[model samples]
Target: MCVEEQWLTPQGIVIGTLLGIVLHVRFSPDDQQVAVCAGNKIYMLSAKNEAILAELDGHLAPVTAAEFCTWEKSMLISVSEDRTFKARKL
Candidate 1:
């Protein structure tokens, strides 16, 4: 599950997972957002406040790796066991 606690205290707001177990996570250059690769889908979330922003769906198998592009601030690259590599715009 990708649930995130809102506060430091034990009693805090929690956000639930979107899909399968997260295998890898990468943060954008600005650090305002993060990308998570779980199962066969990739999810973008707010780094300041862990909230889902967008979902990327295409990979047929579990996503293995994910990284933010240095040259392109708006692009994210991911590789999967499906023998495929994809570049998506953030």
Candidate 2:
């Protein structure tokens, strides 16, 4: 899901939301990227432009949490409502 989207100020026009209810969104350890867990998928986005760079889909159910490895920045870890865990190497 390469959402080529934009974000506005609090008083500006509202933009569309991501694919589904966002469970989690956070910056990477190096502060160069973003990870989002939503609707059984994990989205890796560019921190500078808020563009989706990658979409990870493996869980059978909605993903609950996603986080970047503090030590290894290339890895993205997530847990799903399906009772599973995954580690994606970026």
Candidate 3:
């Protein structure tokens, strides 16, 4: 994976469980934050340590996509199978 080659070293590997099916992943404009859409939730993670920074629980069904705003680093947009979308400011 690109994340393994670029972010992880020879001894590092991604391992764990998320909320559910991971539909999309996106990075902030500054590349300091990561947004992951899994199931019906959006998980905000730190790029440095890959730690959970926040969990956005707004969608009712599975999330389809997620992205961060280029001009505003605090803005996050998401679409879900619940037939709705949300734009939140972090």
Over the stretch 3-84, how does candidate 2's per-residue lDDT look in tens digits?
A: 4433233434222245688888878877777777779888777777647788899999998888888788888889999999
Report lDDT (Cα) of residue 2, candidate 1. 33
Task: Give the 10-residue window scoring lowest on summed lDDT in candidate 3.
Answer: 10-19
> Candidate 2 has which clashing residue pairs, if any?
none
lDDT of 1 by residue, 3-51 (tens): 5654434544333355579898887889888788889988888876658
lDDT against the true structure, per candidate, is 0.82, 0.78, 0.82
Query: Where does the lowest 10-residue lDDT sum fall in candidate 2?
Result: 7-16
Work out the TM-score per prediction.
0.77, 0.77, 0.78
Indicate the residue-level lDDT of 44 in model 3.
85
For every model shown, the clashing-pair count is 0, 0, 0
- Indicate the TM-score of model 2: 0.77
Cα error, residue 31 of model 1, in Å, equals 0.8
Tell how far residue 44 is off in model 2, in angstroms.
Answer: 0.7
- Model 3, 9-81: lDDT tens digits are 5455342244577888887888887888888888888877747899899899999998887687788989999
